[model samples]
Each structure stands twice: as C-alpha cells, then as structure tokens.
Target: STEALSLLEASGYDYTNIELGKEWFLLGGEESVTRVALSKEVESGATSLPKIFVGGQCIGGCSELASLIDNGELDALMKKAGATKKGEPKKNTGFLSFLNL
Candidate 1:
C-alpha cells in the first residue's frame, strides 16, 4: 500500500493512506473526505483498490495511474487539481490554454 501511494505521490498527486479495518471509520470522516471519495470509487466500478480521485472524478488504481503517468494524462489531471509536480507549477502551453479563461 505504501509503495502504491508512493507512485501516486511521485506522479505529483496528493493522496491519503487508509488501513482498512483500522482506519476505515477515520477515513470515512469529513476531515478525510478524499479518502471517503476514493472508497466510493472502489465501491463503484470507477476504480479498483488504491483508488484515486482528481477533481471529484475517479482516476482508478495504481496500475491505471501508472498508465496515465506513462501517457502523460496524469499530469494533466494533477494540473486540474491545482497541484504541481515537485512543487513546480505546470504551465498550460497547448491549445488547452484557449479555454483557460
């Protein structure tokens, strides 16, 4: 679980680790809204274990995350979350900038 979380972190995603049967309730709380949202993603078909949510959308598990990272799609989503890789902001340099306004 730690390794999986590391991959997400390495990919510039902000995530929380929840130990099932131990932190279940704690993760379900309002303070851990992202954790709860991730859990729902797992419950639904949107994502498997080690779930991820970007802007309230399920981004899927570790393997899926890896794929997105490999394909550069994960970086796009991270930017959408107002997050940066290694604390460096991502600049919109492509046609997407036309919609930035």
Candidate 2:
C-alpha cells in the first residue's frame, strides 16, 4: 500500500492512506470522501474491493489502474481532479483538504 501511494505521489498525484481493519468501524468517521477497500476477497469473484471510483464512477482494479497510469490516463484524470503544482493551493481545495481522506 505504501509503495502504491508512493508511486502515485511520485507521479504528482494526491492520495491518502486509510488503514482499515485497524479500527472497529468501516468508515472510521471519515464519511464524505470515497473509501477504496483493498482485499483479497474482492480480487476473487466478489467484485467489490479495490474498486476505483473517480468522481463517482467505478474504474476497475489494479490492472486497470496500471493501464490508466501507463497510458497517461491517470495524470489527465488527476489534472481534471484539480491537482495543482506542488506548494500551490489546488484551485478551491487546500492542501489539507486533499489529504483529508
């Protein structure tokens, strides 16, 4: 998970690390942002975990994510998401706002 986040970060995208299962509740009181649960069960036939939802759309799992990144789709998506240059306030959302997840 750290590696994944680091890769995204190195690529100039904003991300948050939510360690689920450590807490008793699923949402862990952070309800507004999207929650992506990564689990082996979802990787199986369950079709639920590792679900990527950008602007409320269900993008697929690891392979799909990799494809997007490799093909420069992820960078374009992040730019559309209003991710600004480092140290600059991201349009309307602040730095902390991006990390609030």
Best-matching candidate per lDDT: 1
How displaced is residue 60 in candidate 2, in Å?
3.1
Q: Model 2 lDDT vs. the true structure?
A: 0.47
True-vs-predicted CA distance for residue 23, candidate 1, Å: 8.6
TM-score of each: 0.53, 0.50
Report the lDDT tens digits of candidate 2 across residue range 44-77.
Answer: 4233334444443445544566788889788677
Q: Worst 10-residue stretch by lDDT in candidate 2?
A: 92-101
- Candidate 1 C-alpha lDDT tens digits along 6-76: 67657644444544443444554555554455556554633234555555555566677678878978767
Residue pairs in candidate 1 whose N, alpha carbon or C atoms collide under 3 angstroms: none
Specify the poorest-scoring 10-residue window by lDDT in model 1: 92-101
lDDT of each: 0.51, 0.47
- Residue pairs with colliding backbones in model 2 are none
TM-score for model 2?
0.50
